[model samples]
Target: MTLIKKEGPSQMDVVTATASVSDQDSTKDVSPATKDSHTSPADPTEAGLRLYDHGGMVLVPTPTSDPKDPLNLAVWHKCMIIFLVGSYSAFSVLGTSGLSAVYPSLIQAYPNESPARISDLLTYPTLFMGIGNLFSMPLCVTVGRRPVFLFSLLMLIVTGFWCAFSDSLGSHVAGRSFFSMAAGQSEALAPYIVEEVHFLHERSTKLSWFIGVQTVGTAAMFVATTYIVPSMGIKWWYLIITFVNVALLLLSYLFVVETKYERVEATDGAIVHLNFAEADDSRDSESGAVRNGLRLRPDIHGPRTWQHDLRLFHFKPVWSETFTFYKDTFKSLAIPSILWLLLLNGAFLGIYVYQASTFAQVLMSPPYLFKFAYLGWVQLVQILDCVLLVPVLGYGTDLLAKVMCRWRKGVFQPEYRLISMSIPGIAAVIGCVIYGQAAAHPTQWSWMGVVAPYHLGYFAFLGANLVSITYAIDSFPRKAGPVLLVICAGRGFISFGLSYSTVPLISKTGYDGAMNIFAIISGVLAGIAVPMYFLGTRFRLWAMQRLWPKLNQ
Candidate 1:
């Protein structure tokens, strides 16, 4: 039950040595193979292979001797990889939403086109961002994280240049769609990479940081592009995006190593093995070599070095495994608890997009009369929400889980995270009510009043999103990657549809009526968490016991 460095002999040498001893000690006249078979099962400790133990705390999925194992890598190295991938994810989003500020200039350039056509520049890209996940997720799962990410970045850079120079509407839309498709990996794969490198205790906080950077990128782009478009031109704005992508691509090539590792949980359920080596009596392999698991190899030949990481370019897809992955992803939707979580995330995104699409139109008319240049400043509220509220919600939930675990005699349950959702859920309901009512009387309340609810609503909405995603991942760690793909694609598509219908819905229902309707929907969705909080553990247990087996089949 203690971690010890076995540097003198390879793992196979130890296994052979143990086999010889077991054969001599056997009561019956059994062969060496027979003795190993009997001892391996009887001992239950894998013949003294050390279990990672630190001060009575066992490392789940015990790290291998291999320095390239992400868990075994130096803490600084892990942080550097996380930072690099996170930056790539954030910049992808920045590119996706950056053009929102330049719509006016685009309209002038294509005078024959309707405003709606110009709007497609943004809408099409958003739609493709989600669609791209279908392809990106499979590629990342099969080939490798580094190669897929590099490919996506290359597409992003090329499409960015195409968008910057294209003169025709047709060409622009095409370029933007391709650009978004490439950027989609940021949403689909970034969280998966985080999970691959970090432990259970570190997941929620790390994921929060990743999600936060994405929001920052989206918000920062609006502010930067807003100024760039008015001061320079739309082309210059895209050029800036292109330049940033080039820089990120270079960083990714040099530093971002492969994170995919074959992790196996211990059968006794006491620990997890990050790199397991199955015993083979037929061959006397090297000390660190194992036939069935990731063998302990030098960092230079494994994931740690650029030369080894370049192997990601070799595309190899196991068709049956890929098919099974897709099947399981779809099957996961049948679980009600998971379905509800996805809906909650999608509802928040729908509301966010609806508000973003309408806020400019509402403020520009009548009493406030804010100019287009100033409209981009509205995102500052969202930026503040991310900065102040995200840490409180992210780390706050992690702390809550830890405290609850201590109270429960050091046993952690995924349900502990749901308790923190109540506050944000209620806040969202109130924010929606205020925003809905304020939009009805823009002139009377002034733009400030209308915007106040927005700040509150978005803050609460994002908090709920962060908590729910973390909860889902914790509840189903093995399936989290594909599940996240479903969430990302589902929410994006839903948001696109909601955004498209916003103006028509508002015109038909009037701003107050529409907002009220949306408020009711938001409240109902957020309120689902109340019952879930009280009864979620039972549901999770039920799924594990009943639903999971069925889904696997």
Candidate 2:
């Protein structure tokens, strides 16, 4: 904001500057969508005026007028899209950890392989899952959201069949790896949908749904497969999942609209000071309010039709843009805020991933000698955790962000959301400690004990992520586009790296010792948040000013 000397304007010039957007185009919406907002400023200083969105509050990723822009879509319509995406996200996790139910059978099936090696079936696929997430970004940008989603579902279907009939352990592992690769897109791509379609006011809540539904799906799959594998066998589990993919593919094709939008006019998301008047019915963010966007008038394009949604391909393939977007997807990893959030989310997810990968191995061995059929009961407890924590962690943080924003006079501070991290951060450490203690002293704690905390560890994992992701995006709304990729990809790569070590780590350190390590790490990470809450703003600002320009170009 370089200041310039200027001649004084007359009262007439002032009146002209303050005229409503309607003065220019009656047919257009109250808000003009362009790189430059033509609407009057929200605040007038002695020298000039400051502009804003959302009745003088700056809307993040400023709203646009294009009928197809997801931000401008009807509330119910956007909800339906998120609902479908959430469902897709939930089921996607089944491909990652669902096979935990059959770990014993896999051991026998792969007699020549070590138990540690067999764990590769679960561990290694996570790397491929990250790869899949990375792949989805460029495709979703270059191709279309619907095509990428439909294509990933296709991958799941094909790879699922490949896993079901695989005779050798190597083949089965490969199939699982590929199966997860397809499913992993839900982690990256779904969050992008949530970010693009929802407002800053509600973004956290939507992101929590992304986390919560997926966690529930993970637990649900474990429960179902444990029961299924015992009676119908492992192949049936694969077949059932395949059938699920087929149904999901069909549902997606019908309901998942292409979200790749090139605005007829641009509404860049940026905050600015402005003076504007609020109207009586402005509370209605939906419908014909410019707050969201004045809908296409009945005289204009009217409501979007089902025919538009059901269509698959929205754009021609642009290989050049694909490569560019592919690089852009990874660029956020360099931002200090992005890297911090990645570490935070990864730390929390690690506790859950480790628990998930190791649970069957621990319970089915000497101490309890539990049968595979009983693992479902363990997952049920995690399902309970999922149900209990979603409201507390997801919606809770969203409410906090809203309250804090109002306190700051609509100037949102992303750091305020980290207050939600306390409960989960504490829970993460406590859960690790208690779960570790139980694992070490099984004779005292018993098999009944370890699984409960082990299952519930996922609650802490997802809860922390819910806070980290929402805050990270809020901290840098301009870069929110890439937060999905960085956080999800980092989680994938981090979790994958942890896989090779989890089994051996427990073996060397003993159960309690391994958990002690995680407990300390989690506690340390949690402690870092206190400083982050204070300094995070500075770091993000510095990165945006110093680093963003270079990376973006």
Candidate 3:
């Protein structure tokens, strides 16, 4: 009777008892500890990997598994990363634009200097901006991003203060050299942005915003200093900018967390998601307890004191290390995407540096009849440029990816990103022509309508350059930084040559011829995208097949 009662049941009772037995079996087969240890197999389709610490805590590792991660960025911890990576972009533009307003004052302070000599003060910083990267590229990657950024910032801050008070060309040149030393930060920024962000899908948009903000910061400094110099005097302008930079330094100290992470999966800096205290507690008895509470310390660059850090200047016989770095820096030249990057960046940078120098001279001085501050108001168009591009640039690139993904039956290709370059490329050429022609024939044209094209072209320029860089980085996934470094070096050289010579180029060619030349060159090259779109697919496939093996080896 007892057996019958125990065995007997309505169908429901039988099902319930069987389920209870199965649950017991499952519990016995997989202990809670075992269940906690295993990740529910990742979707292989996703590119990133899962990271687990000692306490059964999981983190999404950076984008790669190798000793070096692409960007090693994390989700939800980007503000600091953006700030740190972005610091260089800010420095680059500020150094260039700030001096434009102060040139006359600089001339007054250092009389007996030719306009060309004064311009050297302006030009050399950019020259160094590019040259400094020559050294920083290999060093940053070999040493680390944080150390280079810190050292650069320190050099910039100290030298900048000295520059504000200096009365001689030699001292100013020394200040500018330090300014150049810090310039590598900008070259490093793009890779940092791409590496530490969400994914290939999200990189373009983020990069666009980063570039756009940098433009605003750069443009505003020019516009601001234009007025401030007149009222506050040049020394005050320098002092004010230096003080603003001090704020930037403080921000870096406080919020800009170290990006270098231990777990290969840690993509962003200072993993905010993990509860450090709780993680420590959970793994207190574990053999790998050290890994649980792994917050990165500030001195990740080894225990080099400030004096030792400065002594890098004296660290000789470093030829072996230096040679290795230069070898890596040159790696980008071998990639075709680098050519596109070099062309696009060099063109854009040249036009911008040239225009910034000449436009004020051409417009404010003669036929346009505007004063410096009023000329500053001309930058209002830049406002429109940013207004139009900011919301769309990143998202537009992503949209291009989606459209391309569909075209390929749901497979994504690097070539798809190239399509976004066309509109901007054409816009750039047209802008150069308008800006040049209008300045040449001021009597024949209204300055307002003429200036409109230049600003409009800038919008497209930003979009296209953003497209070019993002695509190149994505396409050459393994060598993004090295590629950008080469591109930047080329751009630096271009910027240096054009900035110094633009006055001469414009004087020799006249505004009409100069603009026409740039227009034609850019227009002809703009067609590169059409072929790029058509042939780009085959090229990328061919390159990927040919290069990845070489790159890996």
Candidate 4:
């Protein structure tokens, strides 16, 4: 009756193990239909009784040893890591955009703050957020994922509280910087989740969900900022969010059991005897010793005590190893798959973050004269982005897959993901134009027309991200995280650059000029999507064959 029952591999075609692995050893073809006639209900525990498809021994959960019992599916064990990471990411995004909606009030509260000074609140956090990834990624690689996640969540909570209560500019800047440190995880954790929880087939949808949820978070903050900041007061809004963030911190600590499983590179039968307790103690001891250069003795640490960390750094081939990592990193930069991802996702990111933070400020103030709470309401536009755009694009992707599969006599092609980009690409350009034109002559259009860019633009924005991210994952199945990291890093840089300069650009050139230029860029980029759609599949194949091999050698 439980959601995740301990079903035997025979009953449900599932496999469980102490170390849930997906290597060649576990890939044996032994479905239920092929079960041997001689085999009865032998003790599955009787030294590795071949359990259905899984060649390795089944590590059954507590309560029963029956191989066919419905009590052990690893998929059902974890409560959807997608939702967990996505929810926490939502908190960080809310923190980032929340201040944008209420900047006027902040300025009024502290009248001496200049435009340059005000800009730092937005710019510095984003700047640090990008740089923070450099540290976060390495830390996750070294210290372990759970600790970083917990530490980041705590940072958000504590700093959010400080930001809420702090009055002075110095405290606000410091708090925002602390919050930025956590906010950077939004980029790093995407791959972390994608790498751990989701399978290759399901990665795109999960990544979309991650991004879509974060978008919703920003939109929700926009809604709340408009409503909460004015009614509850700016300080109270921060306090409320502080509590919410703190709750997330607790949730992470309590429920978020470590998913940072160390990847084993050894072949089957390559025994890694880890004395985890001893490994912990040895790691503690070697932490200081590795500062100079010396491996922790196995005698002192024991088998479980052997760690891959400090040894990685101390290894004589460290430079070559580092070069190899960076070489792999930069090679992805030139990859067409990566470039395509950069183009579509990067464009949307640039526009959305830029418009949401800057233009929302413009629309809500005098002439429009919308109050702070109502200003936050601008985020409602993104609701249309999510509700309307995501489903349509998602369905288009599914339909295209069916069509492509049918064309190939039921053989599916990864190119199916590209079809969804069509509507979003055009819509993005049109939306940008509309927003620019509306801003140019605000009196000419209704609020709907003025806000049309955001609502309509988000359709393409969300769709593009969905398509591109999915496509990237499909192309490089194993290296999806690294590819996504570059995509996210590029997006962050583009968005931050645009956001910092948006006010100045709009001020000097006017909204019409600024948005018109962006619109033109969108149009050109949208046009590129066509050739990309046509040749993208072939390009992926070529990349895998000629391109990747040559580079690897």
Candidate with top lDDT is 2
* Candidate 4, RMSD to the unseen true structure: 12.7
Off by over 4 Å in 3: 1-76, 83-88, 260-322, 537-553
Residue-level lDDT of model 2, residues 453-479, one tens digit each, is 775577787777677767766665545
Tens digits of per-residue lDDT for model 1, 162-204? 9889989999999999999998887668777776676555566
Note the residue pairs that clash in candidate 2. Answer: 42-274, 42-275, 43-274, 43-275, 61-269, 62-269
- Measured with C-alpha atoms, the lDDT of residue 347 in candidate 2 is 77
- All candidates' TM-scores? 0.81, 0.83, 0.74, 0.71
Per-residue lDDT of candidate 3, residues 394-438 (tens digit): 777777776655443334455677777776777778788888888
For candidate 1, what is the TM-score?
0.81
- The per-model lDDT (C-alpha) reads 0.65, 0.67, 0.57, 0.57
Among all windows of 10 consecutive residues in model 4, the one with the lowest summed lDDT is 273-282
Q: What's the lDDT for residue 519 in model 2?
A: 87
RMSD of 2: 6.4
lDDT of model 4, residue 310: 17
Maximum-TM-score candidate:
2
lDDT of model 1, residue 509: 85
What range of 10 consecutive residues in model 2 has the weakest lDDT sum? 10-19
Given candidate 4, what's the lDDT at residue 384?
Answer: 64
